[model samples]
Target: MIDGLSFSLLTPPLIAFTVTLILTGWLIKNNVLKVLDHPNPRSLHTRAVRRTGGLGMMLGVAISWASIPAALPISVSLGVALLVLVSFADDIFGLPVLGRLLMHGAVAIWFSVALLSEARGWMVATIITISVVWMINLYNFMDGSDGLAGGMTLIGFTCYGLTALLAGNESFAVINFCIAAAAAAFLIFNFYPARIFMGDAGAIPLGFLAASLGMIGWTKGLWPPWLPVLVFSPFIADASVTLAKRCLSGEKFWQAHRAHYYQRMVRSGLGHRNTALLGYILMVSAGVSAMWAAHEDIAVQLGVGIVWGGIYLSMMIVSERYLERCPGD
Candidate 1:
């Protein structure tokens, strides 16, 4: 058996897991959750369910961070806090598009300034910030179905945790493990035909954390840049391509729609569960590719992303064709 498995080492994740469970249970008991947001022409759910499950995820992270002894850098903490705040507000009050974008940009700047300070220059910082913000929004866009957001978090963090362990970064490994555990707890309630939705609150913060942690690992030389990109390849492909198509067609970029590739697949009668599982498989493939590319050349890393993008595009085209053939709604 592995030695030194003590409570202190395990405390953070336990705290997070317990907090999520308690918060979710309380929300259910108090009926504080909104159940009136019934499925419509654009929604994936067929019935009314609680739409604030993201609150539980936020609570988990908050409690986890609070329990730790300032182990994380101040800037990272601040960036995450900003994201949680904006996401929570969006979940509750529905902020305007520009407001959300501005807040996201601010958080991205903070994250870059804090974490990438030692990096070469402003150009790198700009790239990191843009990538972070894009990831945050992409994650939010993908959270429409049950288990989707939480599963993605769990998958990404699980890889991070493994990488940390291999690199002997025990503290960072623990942090990633805590995140994975928290997401897994949320997943218990977030599975197909979910009892609660994660909403923007959980998805945005989770995505931010994932992106930030990946950056931290890269900066520390524990992993390469391709790792995080590989981890989130599915969301990036789906959201980016869909957005490109919409922009090409002159649709308002900020307006919500049901044209996401996964959404289209679901509308094609694949069902949300199957579509989500398919995305999960794609994410796992990316993770596997990242692991293999850890010691390989940059070309291999870029190649993996390119191949995955091709596969994603092929699936999207097929799904779009199927959507075309379906009867009008």
Candidate 2:
């Protein structure tokens, strides 16, 4: 038998794997998943498939919490539970936009309040709340293609896990490991030629957890703020620029459309798998930049930011050109 095996090393991933298998099997058997999901004209898939894969993610997280000894902060745990509930309800019954936004706002406030009660100052609390809400939504918006969100979570948690290990933050490392394992299992079904999609249910909560953990890591001085930003830089640049352009053109931001850079690439005949791989390439580059910047001076960090900004602008230009040439919607 393995000596001194802790729940941290054993339980989270195994529990997540078991939960995903059971959830997927149940959804397939009861047809509850099919009631809300169907192949549509705008979709990339060819057949009807379940879309509430986020249920599995939430279940995995819950199991992780139970398996470990006070593994996560009470506030953080509650916040994640709230997000999962709202997201799952929306997946099944479709929540009003205002209600969803309100829920996100409430969770952000709760996190801020909890952190502040722990002696964090007001300004820091404000920044944390805004950043958490924004990152959660960004993850939700970026969940447009197969394996995209899951892949992002995998890379992000891996980076954070390493950072925690190097910093000797073993508890945080366990949390990140759990996240990475959950994302990995989801990716098995979410990869290109997906058997199922994560829908908003999984995407939003995953995003919230990733963003929250990154923030916590930064606040505790275990990692720099730049690290999480670098891990999610590709999605950030694309979503930010696209939203800005849409606002400038007076387009309805909430309505669905094929306008993101990745979407444009797909329209230009780049396969979804290829587009996702390209995103992974960019994420890897950003991860390398982050690792290099961890020890660099302020000037070097600023220079890196400038270089990344230029690269983002160039990609946007290319994407715009591709969209212009593609057939009209």
Candidate 3:
């Protein structure tokens, strides 16, 4: 049985959720920071919303993670802190892209080496490093809409926690669940017509965890890399396909635009709430399926992959046709 889930362990994330909720409310009420994210062509929300709500989630994670007496590496904690620090500063001061990217690259390299410690070959190191960095960017790219990123985190990490439990890795399970709980709390204020956004501070660190923790579990033999990819497939498929299409069309991939499948669905008249809810449904389905299929044999895993592939392909085909039919809607 997945015995790592006890009331004591659950308490931390519960406390985190409560604190995050209260803290987010306080920020919204006080308008804590004067800085706001104004609407541009790419924005889903039309009004200026305070994006500092990421602070609450950060606080929740910090307090709860501190409560855990586990002996995780100090360097890992330091790297995560640095990422949040840089992202938070950028959220407030709008730091230059080059500097932010440099910081991201530095942290990515450190963790890439740590995660790939078992196989120090240059090719392995280089590939995983690029993958982790891409995860960070892809996550940020997918966070434009309300509740989208938060919901994905909840589902994705919870799936990770479940897989950890199955692997008898109680410590990893608790950590993943804690992150999920905090994200759930953030979702309270971040849902459709959000009063506050998570901004870079929340998004960046979360993206880092998604890749790092996923790799950690893989290294430990808790789950295969494909499992995490399937766990976060909704996001992976959307962001990767969009990025590829943009590159193929010679578009400036670094620039922001309302081009993601989720964004396009919203712009095509689905609205934020519907699009977000549908995305959540897909997340839950994919996560649950991955969680169940992780224990199966390689043949079973391959079969699962093929089925999901068809499903995603069907979605792409149907969505494209539906949008075309409603081009002026």
Index of the highest-TM-score prediction: 3
Query: On a 0 to 1 TM-score scale, where does candidate 1 land against the true structure?
Result: 0.91
Question: lDDT tens string, model 1, 267-322?
Answer: 77888788778878977878877877786888876787688778777987776677
Candidate 2 clash pair list: 54-202
Q: In candidate 3, what are the lDDT values of residues 1-329, reduced to their tens digit?
A: 43555865687788788888889888899944776899876687889999887788888887887777674555457777898889989988889988988888888888777766665577877877787788888898899888999999999999998889888987778888888998999999999888889889888888888887888788889998788889989999989988888899888888888778888888888988999999999999999989888888999999999999999989988877887644311
In model 1, which runs have C-alpha deviations exceeding 4 angstroms? 5-9, 33-36, 67-70, 326-329
Arrange candidates by lDDT, highest first: which order? 3, 1, 2
Q: Supply the TM-score for candidate 3.
A: 0.94
Q: How many clashing pairs per prediction, in order? A: 0, 1, 0
Score residue 202 of candidate 2 by CA lDDT: 82
What is the alpha-carbon lDDT of model 1 when measured against the actual structure?
Answer: 0.78
lDDT accuracy of residue 171 in candidate 3: 77
Candidate 1 residue 327 C-alpha distance from true site, Å = 11
Rank order by TM-score, top first?
A: 3, 1, 2
lDDT of 2 at 271: 72
How do the predictions measure up, each by TM-score? 0.91, 0.91, 0.94
Q: After superposition, how far is residue 155 of candidate 2 from its true place, in Å?
A: 0.8
Best by lDDT: 3
Scored by Cα lDDT, where does model 2 land?
A: 0.77
